[model samples]
Target: MSSPPAVPVTLAEIARLAGVGRAAVSNWRRRHSTFPPRIGGTDVSPHFSLADVEEWLRSNKKLGKATSREWLWPRFEALGDRNETGLAIAVVGRLLAAGEGDDGGPDDVGSGAVRAAVELGQREGPSDILTFLLRRWLDTYVRQITTTPEPLADLMADLALWVRESIEGEPREDVVTVLDPACGVGHLLAAAATAVPAALNRPAALLGCDRDPVLTALSDVRLALLPRPGTLPPMPVIASGDSLRADPLIGTQADMVLCNPPSNERDWGYEDLATDARWVHGMPPRTEPELAWVQHCLARLRPGGSAVLLLPPTVAARKAGRRIRGSLLRTGALRAVVALPPGAAAPHSVSLHLWVLRRSVAGETPSGPEELLLVDAAARFPRSETRENGPEWSELGAFIRSVVGASGGRAAGGARNGATAEDADTTAWATVVPVIDLLDDEVDLTPGRHIMSAPGHAGPRLTDSWNEVRELLDGLQTERARLAALDLTSGAADQPNATVGELLRAGALSLRSGRHPTEAVAPEPQHARIPLLTLSDLLLDGSPSGWTNPDDAVVAEPGDVVVVGIAREFSAWVHEGPPMAVGPQVHVLRADPQVLDHWFLAGSLKAPANARHAGTHASSSSRIDVRRLQVRRLSLPEQQHYSEVFRHLAAFERLVERLGIVARKLGQDLGDELAAGRLAHGK
Candidate 1:
C-alpha cells in the first residue's frame, strides 16, 4: 500500500512559505477560486495539504525560497502526536550521528520525515540541522517545555565554575565532571561543559538525569552534538529517570553541579524517601521540594565542589524550610543568594533566586564567623520601555563574583584589605550578612531584607526627587502650550472618504500584518539585532522592549503607520524612530507621501467611528478589519496641518502621563521618608 500523505500545514505556515502576511493568505483564499481547500485542522486555524499548497504556489509563482529545514518541520509536526514528533527528531539525530542511510524504521515517524531530515542534514550538516529542528520543536511546545534562558544559563554555569576554582585553587588537569540532576533538555549541562576555559586544560564530562525519557534522549542528542574543544571528554552521560527518587547517579559525585530544579513539587517522593541519607541538612518538609533538591545537589558534590541552583524566591523565606535553611547556613554549605530580576525565566512575574553552595572539604572548619553574601539585583530590572535583556548579565555576574571573591579572601585571612570604595558603592545592592544573624526564628534568607538593612545603604534622595518632579512639571507646561497653539475651526459640511482597501487598490498605501515569532523564538532586549514593537508596547505607548532575528522581522519604517489589529483600546500611531519589527496582529500601513500623509492616516485610523464600523465583534475587545476602515480624503496641505495638531496632541498626552508618574513617585518617597523619620520639614 502507498505511504500515507505527508502532514498538512496551518494557514500561518502557508503564509510563511509564501513570504506574505496572514491577511494576504486570507485574501488569496477568498479571492482566488483555485485556492486549495482545507484538508484538516479546525476552521479557526485550517490546515492544507503541503503538496497541494506547494503545487498551487508554484503554479501561481507565489512560493518563496524556503529551505529544506523549514519544509521538514511541518512533516515532523504532521506526525500528530508530540511524543512522535520528539521521537522523530531524536531518530533524525541518531541517523545523522551514525551517518546511516534512511531505511524505513520501526518508529511510527513517516519515511517522508526521514528523507527530509537526510536532505537537510546534507545541506546544513548534522549539528546545524539538529539544532534548528530542536529549536523549532521547542518553540512549537513552548508552554510545555521549560528550558533555562540562555543568559541565565551562562551566568549559572560561570558562577559554578568560579566557585569551584576559588575553593579548589587551580583547575585539575584530569577530566572535570559536571552534573545536573534535573537537566531539562541539557541547557544547564551544555552550558557547564562549554564554560570550562581552555586555559585550564581540563576537559569536561557532563552527567544529566531527568524523569522524561524523551527529554533525556533529546538532551543526549543535544550534548552529543555540541561543538567541543579538542580536549573534550567522551559523550555526556545522560540518564532517563526521576533523579530525586531513583538516584540514577547515586554515589557518583561531580566536581560541579548546576540545576534549575522543578519547584513546588509536593509529590517528589517525600513520604518514601523520609529517611534518605541525602537529607543531611534535615528532612525537607512536604511543602519544600526545592529544599530536597538543594540537599541532593550538595550530596552529589565532591569535597569543596560547588553547585548553583536557580530556585524560587519563596524558598528563602518560607516557614516550612526554616530548619533546613538554618542547618545549611550553620554548616556553611549555602554561601550566597543572588536575587534575579523578574522575567529572568519561567513564571515571568516573580523574581527568582540563585543559591550558590559549596560542599565543605574534609577537616575544614570556619576560620572565623561564616558570612552569606546577598546580592539584590531586583531594583536593576529594566523598565518596561527600556530595551535591555533582564539586567546586563555580565555586570551583574561580575558584581556577584567580586563580593564572593572578597568574602573568600576575608575568610582566608589574606593580605587583601576589607571592602574598597567601589565595593562601598555596591553596598546598596550587595552586602555580606553574618550567618549567625540569619539563623533567627524565621531563618529568612531573602536578599532584600539583608541588603536594605546593611550599613551605608543609600536611600532615594529628597532633592533628586523634587528636581525630577520640577522637570516633569516644566515639560508638561511646554507640551500644554504647544497643544493650545493648534488652531481649530469647523470643517465643510460634506467630506469625501475612502476605505483602506480603496487606497490600497489606488496605490496610495501598502498594508501588511506583522508575523508572530515562533513560540520557541522569543524577543530579547539585547543580543538580538532587530527591535520588535509588540501589541503591549502599542497599548502602553512605550518604546520597543525586545528584539528578534532580522530574518523573521517585518520591519516598519519611520513614516509607516502602525495600528493594533485586535484590542479593547484600539490605537494607531505614526512610527518615528529607527526601523523596527512590527509584532503579531499589528497592521503596518505605508502611505505614499505624495498622495497621503502618514500622520493623517494614523490619526484617521484611530477615529472612534472607524473602530465601530471595522470591528469584527461588538465586545469590548475586537479584531479590526483593516481593509474596511474608512479615512477622510483631505488635501496634502490640510493633512499636514491636521498632522501637526495630532503630533502636538500625542506629545501632550505623553507629558500628562509622565507628570502623573513623577508626581506619584514624589508623593510616595516623601510619605515613606517622613513616616520612617528619615526626613523633616525645614523652616
Candidate 2:
C-alpha cells in the first residue's frame, strides 16, 4: 500500500537525515541486527531504503531530527555515476512538470528516481518538492558549473531588462518577446519574468538555448514556475544546442537579447565557421570567442533593439579582440562598457565588463557615432572581505541611468567621491570616449584607462592646506583642554554594584550573544542588502560594514551596547544605527532605562581592570566573559550625569580621530603637490 521505501540513500545521507555522524550510522549498521540491509551501491558506500532506515532508527530511538527535502537530494546524488546522477535529476524534473498522476510523458521512462519523484510528489506536493530540489541543485551543481555568481545573475538580468525596456519604449502591449542564447538555469529569465506584470508589455514569449541538455531542462522548469499575470505566455521555448553553431530558432528575432555567454572558449567554431554571417562586425580571433557571442546576440535582436552581454575585461582590451571591438565601435553597435569589481562573477577574479549594444535601424543612429560611454563602476563594490560581491541595485540603477541619460557624448557628471566645482562639467567615473581616441594602435577599450584620463579638479593650494592644518591644531588644543577638565574624579570611590549576570537575574538588563558564525549556510538573497555589524567593522568605522540577513541571526537595536569577545582588553560600543545582525565574536546588552545607563554600562565594562578579571585567556583565542563584569549602581539622575560625561569623552575620542585623518590627508596632498613642483613651504 505504501511507496516502496522511498529512494535508496548512502550511509552519509542516513547520518544527515538522522542528524548524526557517519560513524553513528556505521555503528548502528554493525550493532543493530534489525538495521536495513544494503539494497544497492558498493560495499564501501552501501545504500539503504529511506523507509527501512527511518523505521529502524525510530524503533531504536536514534532518529534525531525530521527529514526534509534537503535531505532527499543526497539520495539522488548517491545513484552511483555522475552522468546517471544528472539523468536522475532530469527525470525527477520531468516527472514534476508532468503533474502528479500523468506518468511523466516521454522523459520519465521509469527509473528509481522517477518512482522516488512520484512518491515525493505525493508526500510534499509537486510544487514544494520541485522548488526545493531545484533550489538545492542551484546551490550546489549549478553553482559549480555556471560562470555567473547568483548575485551577478540578478544584476545582468536587471541591466538586460533595462535595455529591453529602453528599446521597447512603452505605451502598453500585452505581449513581449525576450531571449537568452546561453541561459543557465534561467536566472536571467526568471528575473526578467518577475518584471512582466508591471511591464507596459508583458513577456509573452521567453526563448533560450544552451549547450548543456541538463541545464536547458532545468531552465525550462524554472521559467515555467515563474508567476504570470492574467494568462501564461505560450510555454517557454528552450532548446538544447550551441547557439552560435546553428541558430535553433532561425526565423525568430527577439526584441531584446540578454546573454552571459561562455568566455575564452577556444573551440568556438572559429576555424570551421570562418565565413559565418554573424561576424558582420569583423572576423573574431581564435582567442576572443566572446566577440563571436556578441555578434550572435546582436544578430538575434530586431532592428533598433538592444542587447546586453557580460564579457571579460580582456574582451575590452585584448590584442586579438581589437578588430572586432573597433568594428563594433565604428558601427555604433557598442553603446557602453561598464567595468564591475573583481569577484563580480564566479571563477574569474578579473573585473568584468557589461557591453551594452544596439542594432541600428534606418532612422536611428546612436547618440554619438564617434564616441562610446565608459563607466568605471568598480568603486560601488565593497572592499571588506566578509561582504558579498553583489552590486548595489541603487548604484547599478544610477549607472544604468548615467549610461542611458548621456547625450551628444556629454552629460552632467561629477566625481563618485564628491567632485570639485571645476570638474563638474564632465561626468566622474563614467566618461564618453571618442571613437578616434579608442581606435589608436592598441585599441584598448578598458573603461579605467579612458575614464581616468579625463582631467580632474586641480590639487589643493599650499596656502589652503596650511590654513586647514592651523585650524585643526587650534581645535585639537581646545579638545585637549576639555578632556583635562572632565570631572570623572567626582564619582563615588566605594559604590555598591553587582555583576552583569546578577543584574540580568534581577531584571535590570538583558544580555544576548550572537550565533557563532560558520560556513554551513548563507542568507537568502536580498536586493536591498544591509551591512552586518562585525567586531572589525565596529572597530574601524563605528558602523555596520558587512552584509547581514534578517533571518539568520539576532539584530542589535539602537540602545543596545555591543561588546567584542576577543579584544586586547574589554571593549564595548553603543550601537547607533538601525537594527543589524551581530557577528560571532560580538554580544549585545540591552539596559533598563530606569535601572542602568547604556553609556555607563558600556564604559565600565570596557575598563581595563574589569576586562582582565573576566578571564585569563591565551593570545591565540582571547575572549571576555561579559556576564562576570561588574556594573556600578547609580540612581537615574546620577547615571544620566555620568552618561553625559561619557558621551563627552566619546566625542573627544572622535575629535582626535578626525584630527588624525585631516592631518594625514593634508600632509599627503601637500607632499604630492610639492613633488610635482606645485607647492613650497614659503608660499
| Top candidate by TM-score | 1
Pairs that collide in candidate 1 are: 139-520
Worst 10 residues of 1 by lDDT: 411-420
Return model 1's CA RMSD, one decimal. 6.2
lDDT of 2 by residue, 42-107 (tens): 997687877788788888898777555645675665554444666566666666666644354343
**Which candidate comes out best when scored by lDDT?**
1
Badly placed stretches (over 4 Å) of model 2 are: 1-12, 19-49, 60-67, 102-110, 122-127, 138-144, 167-173, 366-370, 385-426, 453-683
| TM-score for each model | 0.77, 0.61
Badly placed stretches (over 4 Å) of model 1 are: 1-4, 18-46, 52-63, 106-109, 168-173, 197-199, 366-369, 382-389, 392-407, 410-425, 453-471, 485-643, 662-683
387-466: candidate 1 lDDT, tens digit per residue:
34455665655555555555555322111212233453355667788888898999999988876422323254557767
Full-model lDDT for every candidate: 0.78, 0.68
